[model samples]
Target: MRDIPVVLSGYKLTVVEPPAPNTRDDGNGGQVVVTDRQGVTQFVVALFAKLRVGPGERAPKGEEIKVTLLTDPGLGFEEDSRVELVDPRINAYQIDSPDGRSISGISFKAMGLKPVRAPREEK
Candidate 1:
């Protein structure tokens, strides 16, 4: 299925883990780096997403998701830093096993990520 675009305006994203190279195991017991169609290295960034709550609303709920980036998100994005996903999209996938088991879920991908600066207080 085609990826669905996601708008995150109502949610806050925080980096739970720093960026890391996305790789797969090669047959020779080595790891092969994963890249996009354009040959740009892909990276995985773990983020914690929390829904914004209004007055009298229930407690905020959040979930952690690892996003695949087509290219590096650059510096300044570190663990515990607030961030925003650039051009985020969600794709649904399912894998069937020979043991009659199956796994299905959504995956997240993004063009990049940027740090979200906090608003400055006024005097």
Candidate 2:
């Protein structure tokens, strides 16, 4: 199975859920970080974001969608922080299921996130 390309955004991007440290196992006794071909490790952050349905799709506003972000070191986002994802895409991986079945799992990845700039307070 493959991950369907998903572009999730919103006018009011609130966090309904939060992200946790996502880890993986290696063949060795020790665990490993999820990195790219360049060996750059990416931190995983998962959360449910309240967003409106993007163009080309018919959906209601304020639709909540689960978004996963894989970022480089020193990148972290907070709950209810308004932000935008750059070039976000989905990654689908085939995993072994408990019922002896192969299944496709989905996660989201992006170049990074930029905080939506708030209006400058008139001092």
Candidate 3:
């Protein structure tokens, strides 16, 4: 079994259509420019959410980012599960477990897409 570690940030989520599974060619065909929150436009894929992490400090790798999808707290969540990157900029997302339970966790590092830019204006 392959072990993948991850970090999480607290943020709510709303599901969006999933991306194509192995379609990594960013320049596959005619692309379109899309507007972002920072007032800048760029050619990009439609965004979506996959998980939700609660408020607080980020979790360290190997640490489980607790999530409570149900009204009850007795049912908890695990880390490193398959989560969706709902918002590319913030890395916000949500996901459903194998048992059909829903939970959200920050994709602060979705597939390790780190070194992410700081939206220019902030710089």
Cα lDDT for residue 46, candidate 1: 92
In terms of lDDT, model 2 sits at 0.60
The weakest ten consecutive residues by lDDT in model 1 span 52-61
Q: What is candidate 3's CA lDDT for residue 86?
A: 24
Q: Pick the candidate with the highest lDDT.
A: 1
Model 2, span 1-123: residue lDDT tens: 444555664455544544444457888887876666676666554444654556697645454555545654244457776666666777777888799999876666766566676659898
Ordered list by TM-score, greatest first: 1, 2, 3
The reply for model 1, stretches above 4 Å from the true place, is: none
- Which is the better candidate, 1 or 2, if ranked by TM-score? 1
Candidate 1 lDDT over residue span 1-123, tens digit each: 666999997888999989888989998999999988888899999999999788788756799999998778888888899998889999999999999999999999998998889869899
Tens-digit per-residue lDDT, 1-123, candidate 3 = 122333333423222222222222348674444433664432212222234434585533333222211111111112222333322333355788999998974532222211222236654
For TM-score, the strongest prediction is 1
* TM-score of model 1 (CA atoms): 0.90
Worst 10 residues of 3 by lDDT: 68-77
What global local distance difference test value does model 1 have? 0.90
